[model samples]
Target: MTHHAYADRRSGSRTHADGRPPAPPPLPVAARRGPAGRRLLTGLFLVGLVASVLPWWLDTPAGSLTDATATTTAAGQITGLLAGYLLLVQVLMMSRLPVLERVVGGERIAAWHRDLGVTLLVAVLAHTAFILVGYGGLTGRSPWDQAGVMLREYQDLVSAFAAAGLLVLVGLTSVRAVRRALPYELWHATHLAGYAVLLLGFAHQFSNGTQLFRPGPVRTGWIVCYGLVVAALVWGRLVGPLTVNLRHRLRVADVVAESPDTVSIYLTGVRLDRLALLGGQFFRWRFLTRGCWWQSHPFSVSAAANGRWLRLTVKVVGAYTGDLRDLEPGVRVWAVGPSGTFTAAHRVRDRALLIAGGSGITPLRAMLEELPPGAALIYRARTPADVLLHRELDWLAQARGVRIWYVVGSRNDPGPRQVMSPDGLRRLVPDVARRDVYLCGPPGLVEQSRRLLRRIGVPRRQIHVGTFEL
Candidate 1:
């Protein structure tokens, strides 16, 4: 096998012909979240709330109605409006727009996406039930009969029912228990059905919704909202990766085993510095190799990108990742970007507290190299063998004068857990509460750490969490 010179080292800086480190990449514009973004989001929420009541306000009969039928119809209309708005919001979140991701961290966006998804599902159900009830009462028929009549009588209602059914299936699979049981590929494919679900909803609304039947600002607003969301989704999720891959011409240069189950895949590309990837951010990587090309997986940069090479350390937790161990050099790579907000740029406090567990060390390890002085790291692993990239981590600690604390032991051994506890943490880092803490680990550990940090007086905004698990 031919060796690649660029893959041999992991450093952030690149030397030019004159022997100086090349100029650093320009900082991303969205790095700072100011008043404008907050105000925009607030305005969106307020506008939706106002729109939910617009239909009733505009209809003269609705204002003077004093009957149960009118009340049911009004309830149905309001729920439908709110449901449509929420569904659109969820689509925007799914778009993976960089500006939004930077302003709101990837984790927060993901959390909101999940919450909004469930809420939208609930809203959709409420809209359907109420509408059926209202129509049934108006026509003097049972809701069941009305549902069948609506489905048969209206083309839009047929598509709406289909969309709702798909939404229900998607929601069921999204349940933690159900999602965990499904294979990643299967879950991903099922999730993509959400796009169709959203489109079907659009069709249903524009065709049947009373508020949007007539051409006006309300209809125009709905169309423009959906158009923008669809464009963002197409650009950010689809077109963006294709453009990046074509421009960078990335290919696997080498694969180095870090542990029995973990390997670092090195990629080389042209003018890679232009990717603007900070340490601690990750990309959804798709290796165009037989058996693994179909599924893309998220992995953090194990080191800073230096234009010559990019690195991602992944563990063999499943079949797809396990195959990565055998991935040969020269395989083309497709990537979807330098995402996540867990970086040195977000650090506000003078001192920094970096925490990692298992493979979670990938991003935090990169962060250690980029973070300034006064930063400390707490690495937790089942054993010394499980601690990845110790050689580089130790070198960074000694060279930079940063403190490294390794909490090594299995769960069966009390040492690791004890060290992570509030008392133990306080003992390890005396001024922990005053520091800006960056944590990357399992959900359970991260949650526990956040709780401990909160109890120990660390402000919520001062603690940032990054998860490797997508």
Candidate 2:
């Protein structure tokens, strides 16, 4: 394939020496709504929390805490309420809602989901403990015996216990080490049980909850909350994607090998002008082929949307990705996004510094087409042969007035170590602190670069990060 085939296509009418279009103008800063969206979401969550606990506060009188059993029961009620609310929060965060993804960004939502997962597990466990102990004290029996009695007598209690076990298993699998040890598909499939946990735990909340047992506004409100979360999940996960795929009718146009381990899949669809995509955004792609039809994976566009085609550069790191290399033209693709906030619209500064390791350059390569002039890119790879799209990057540098540095070496090599050091970064970029630093790569490289950037006086807020992790 010719180099021009991979060049930026967002250039409207302007043509360059190489016959490719010129880079487009940067997006306006006002286009980004992250800070305002974050505040709005936070306020809404706090309000919901207050509402969730209000019935408990009203029902329990001050004199009700006269005994150890009463106090324990009260604690159990509060913990159960919090856990229910938090479970909703966790699901909403990952629902892939367009508004949330556009305003708050997918990366931030994923981070929140990970942190809250831990808290949700703790709250659920605490609620179970408090209930067993409180009931045991009241019945003059051991907690274990009380658990058995409750399980035998209470309606939906068996399902609740099953939900608790499933939740615990999900939590254990989510641990970084465990998650890493498992295959991506297995880990992702395991996480799907979280929805089952919600379903199993639902009936118990209304059947047994002290504050929810009787029909009232409190119960109605909780039901409404559940309905809203379920609606969001359906729309975000199902309806929205179906609509986009049906409208676009995306099909694989071609697949070209960029390196021994990497290939770029070219996609074409109908009415591309209406796709409304930006550089650095990604889609969860599901190719409609026998072996690949069921699995959907997220991949960023390696080149800016040019109204006629979209490109995704992928490295074959696992079986799923390895399958992508063999996809033929004309195969239909179901895509779920055009998501992520790693675009020029989200930049905090006029000039940007992009640090890419391995295949992480894909999004950065696309972003260069929209960033304002004078942006700099540092591409890191273990060897020269490992670099992907060097020609395209070189062409972009001259066309967009970007400065390019290809850093090649082992992680322990002195040259790479110094170049990544605080002093080395300052010397190369000179005004690194004044620019927005966009980092993407392996976990270790991204973390190390972030530390060095901070040490060189770059504020944490100025650093934007992208990762392959879901």
Candidate 3:
């Protein structure tokens, strides 16, 4: 459908029954209420910031839920909801990243995304309150009696434990100060703990939840959903990597370092195409015979899908990718994907706003060739040197109806940050509010562009960004 028709169909969609516009229906819980949400707590935080400034919710006093037992019950429900929802959100975010890039417009889904995140957060907090109330019956002397009561009856002990574990895992990651101070490798390992917490939560629900444990279809349905989520995470996060390692893979191809620490690797192995990848997808390639599986990292494909050879342009970021420039042409490398589905195909908007920062420019370079006409690009790089695909981008810009903006930040002795935040894109583009904006790159750039767009009155329905570059 045309943009106008599509928007009309999706809007409150008031039907004229004998010439009167009907009131909008209540928001559906199953559907995503917004186009998309921020990743994990990050999206929650951005929305939270937005929420704090507005009187969106009803008036509730500081101790509105002051009743001790009531408060505990409310907290328990909220916590339960949060843990389950976050797990689902993280999995969805990671899995959708690759394909989401292919689509042109994400803002259309913005409402659903925002609503899901908010609802889930509230559920978790409520879940926590409920659990607290349940446990309040236990004094120091009555701990065993509470335990006996829990054990004697088919209560949700397992789920409660799972809820506690999920909370702990989410809580630890929630602390930005702690997460940032830890090395990437360390943080990554610790984050995997969520998988275990989720598994326990699933078991707890089956054992405790009144709805989930019922006989026949009701129980089976929840079991299936819980199983699918855990299975997807295992396949995407851990098992996929292990399977690649077990296959005894070969590197097969290597790149001629275009610059220091940056080189392209042409990978060839058994059934590479069968790896099920799209043009802008990525992989966590592990080249071993040495270190650990914990070191494998994600890299985006700099080239489009050709079906014959899988290609990647990687710059040495730290430990794993740092040594990538020197990889032997014939060395053995375990490739764990054709993963992530971010491309421009998912867009309904013909005209687009494409933004990129630092290494983030690589994936966009691949997407640019595939982008339909009338697409605008704003690329941020430090000086002319750090601009990775200048030649390719410029060539695409030469295509009719394409606009390109290169923001160079540093003036003298340069660094990546010299061009990091391309605030200049805001001033240069006067009509930005009309287009759907897709951003990839540093967090600062993505965050800034979004804020700038909002300040200029672009509907929240038109701005989009992924949680991470990959």
Candidate 4:
């Protein structure tokens, strides 16, 4: 391979659909939910209660239902609260991310964020199930048996069907493998339907809920909270986009062939502080005229807080990354994010594990520079030639308390030492379970290390694996 191509030691990649490789995968999930999750949950529960109870308190007669007695009314109210609880939890986990990002570093925050996402998905699914059952019981029809009244042109029934469709879409993306199968560009567009889903959920709660007749102090409180959260989401989606388009601007400064397939770009952007970015968070960087901005490529800041300079390490893999090695510096770029919550500084327990595969080492390098003490680093690359900045890494390890374990995949003429597999990890560190493990590598290697750690008794929480595609 040419030195330029060989210089960029990105990950192994297959030829993309368009006959070029894309950007290699990025660091895994971010750490979300510290004090933020709890607060949002509390706020949402209140709002849901009020949304449900207001109609009842307002002295409005119960709508066209035969069983409008206090028991049924109470049941509906309980259903709304439970359903609202789920919504609140989901929003809490996704929103107010600034606070959560502070608690944990950016990369693993994203992974945990996705994991918690599954939690929210389950909540929505269960809430939907409960609503269907409750409404069906009232109508004397099975929840799944929607043939009769749904055809009657009732506004409420029509709303129910719409809500059902949206729920189905959300549920479809909940599965892990299915999610990976979908094109990310399409997935994001589909994900935005969440706003519509929220709207439908609120409308359903408002028009059909028995609690709206409630003339209570608590009902008023719920109304205020629900309105606030919805308003915030609208601002986030709408205003957030406008701001990205205008305020936080990025311009590509340089593209260097660090390894054959792997390249690095330096970004000079305005409003770094305004971005409210934590170190390990990533962005959906689109070179606009070149790469897929609409598609949103997620790349972590290899080294951020450069005041105005942000570095992104890339490895060619597909449509987005194919031409990265050829790009010149100083090109204007538009990117969105600072998303995901994966990083250190949150784990009060000092000891840690930092695993890096090729360019995935970028974010962890920044993390180590920021807080180098009390951590063990496992840097793995295909061959010894692939290890970039080895001397610098070694110097840092000696200065700071970072223990280094370099696993060169190809080590011929070995002196009775091996560094390629999980067995190498076991030999290098006997106490893997006791420390907080931080891994940043290809999915395959990360998964292998994770399984080994688990088998050896590392708790899931302690094994901070970076798996977010960004």
Q: Return the top candidate by TM-score.
A: 2
Error of 2 at 285 (Å): 0.9
lDDT of 3 by residue, 207-287 (tens): 654334456664564456566666665565567666755653546454545455466666666655455444445666676
Runs with alpha carbons beyond 4 Å of true place in candidate 3: 1-166, 201-217, 230-252, 269-279, 336-342, 398-405, 411-434, 455-459, 466-470
TM-scores, one per candidate = 0.91, 0.94, 0.63, 0.72
Flag the better candidate by lDDT, 1 or 3.
1
Question: Which tens-of-lDDT digit does each residue in 1-470 have in candidate 2?
Answer: 32233433445321223655455434433335336667898899899888878889988887879999989988899999999999999998888999988887777788889999999999999999999999899989999999999999996999999999999999999999999999888989999999998899999999999999999998998999999999999999999988998899999877877788888888889988798788888999999999999999999999876788889999999899999998988999999888888887788778999999999999998888888879999999998878988877888788789999999999899989889987888889999999999999999999999989988899887899988877
RMSD list, candidates in order: 3.9, 2.7, 14.7, 8.3
Candidates 2 and 4 compared: the better one by TM-score is: 2
TM-score of 2: 0.94
| Candidate 3, position 378, lDDT | 77
Task: State which candidate has the highest lDDT.
Answer: 2
Residue 418 C-alpha lDDT in model 1: 81
lDDT per residue as tens, model 1, 1-470:
22222223643332212323333332322334333664687687778768756765775463555788777877888888888778778878778887777666566777888888888889889888888898899999999999999888899888789899999999999998999999877888998899888878778787888788878887897788788888999888888777888899899977877887888887888888787787888888899997988888888998876777889998888888889988898999998877887887777676789888899999987777677766899988878889888767766776556799988887557887787788888999999999989988877778878998999999988898897655
Candidate 3 lDDT (Cα, 0 to 1): 0.54
Candidate 3 all-Cα RMSD: 14.7
Task: Please report, in order, the local distance difference test score of every candidate based on alpha carbons.
Answer: 0.80, 0.87, 0.54, 0.60
